[model samples]
Target: MNNYKEKQLEKSAEHYAKKVFKVIAAIVFGAIVFGLAIYVLMRLWNWLTPELWGWSTLTYWQALGLFVLAKIIFGFGGEGACKPKKGKKNKKKWKMKCDMRNDFSDWKLYDEFWTVEGEAAFKRYIENHKKRHHENEQKQS
Candidate 1:
């Protein structure tokens, strides 16, 4: 009975190990394919934009700089092209407060000017307004 249990445990362990290996293999394969696609795209872009690629206009170092800049601007990997190092402060601080109109018609002017915190504030304001309105209706009834 002990021998059977040990064999079953070993089989289970081997099955889990195979799963882990498969996952790692898939991740590596995905990375390689993604890298190849990026390389192909960059090559095509360079070929098409001859003015942006010439040695006189952009040396090796300049080309690298431009590539880095483009990556920063476009956010190639979705979240950001490059992650900031630990302990490094982000230099760009968005202005939180702006001249926001109190009237509902002018709400559109402030639509793009809000931070996440500001959005929460606005939502809370709306909720409070609705609650007050409901309370007033209850009092009237």
Candidate 2:
């Protein structure tokens, strides 16, 4: 029993160590990529700006700051892409707001609604509007 427990504890510790190592590796990789991006941006700015626009070349920190500012202004990731994920309940409302494609599935029912109730609703609205306008004119007079 003691041996089994010890083995189990060791296995758990190994698993936790592997997870920690993975997280550390990911953080290191992300930092490297981030530094590389800043370096590339600085190099490109130095290569192009002084010759083309007579602008001052950016330093490493300035390039990093500019990248951060651009991200803040333009934002990150697919914001308005509107791809619905699994388990979202308000799918219809989400699609209506984000989907700009011309062939919206809901529009297919528009003709049906217009034939059934839209025309009657419009005439009723028009009549009510005219009555309100006439009443306003009379009150003004």
Candidate 3:
């Protein structure tokens, strides 16, 4: 019984140590990547600006500050962004709207709408439509 408990304790300790090591390694890697990006940005800014715009080159921290500032200014859309909601009712509503918009898609059946047969059909449809409108107007009158 004591040996079993000792083995379980060792296993738990090892599991926790591995978890902690992974978290620490991820943090260190993220920091290194972020610092390298900032250095590269500063170098590019220094290489480009002075030649093209007569602007002074930026240092590492200044470039990092500019990046953060840009993110603060333009990165977040707050609430104005249209995001797709996963609700069934919203999906149904959006689908219904799309279906309504596409109700006339069947009218695009002809490659050339002014084809000879299509023109005759068009005239028949228009005459029928006008007759219905005339009847409606006469009834109203």
Candidate number with greatest lDDT:
2
lDDT of 3 by residue, 1-141 (tens): 999999999999999999999999999999999899899989999999999999999978899998789889888556332434555357666767767766887778666666858789989999999999999999999
Question: What is the total number of backbone clashes in candidate 1?
Answer: 0
Write down the RMSD of all candidates, one decimal each: 17.5, 6.8, 9.3
| lDDT digits (tens) for residues 38-115 of candidate 1 | 666566666666766552333444555666787899766743323344554653321111113223676676756687
Best model per TM-score:
2
Decreasing lDDT order of the candidates: 2, 3, 1
Q: Would you estimate the TM-scores of all the predictions?
A: 0.38, 0.63, 0.55
Q: State each model's CA lDDT, in order.
A: 0.68, 0.92, 0.85
Where does candidate 1 have its weakest 10-residue lDDT segment? 93-102
Assess the local accuracy of residue 83 in candidate 1 as a C-alpha lDDT between 0 and 100. 39
Clashes of each: 0, 0, 0
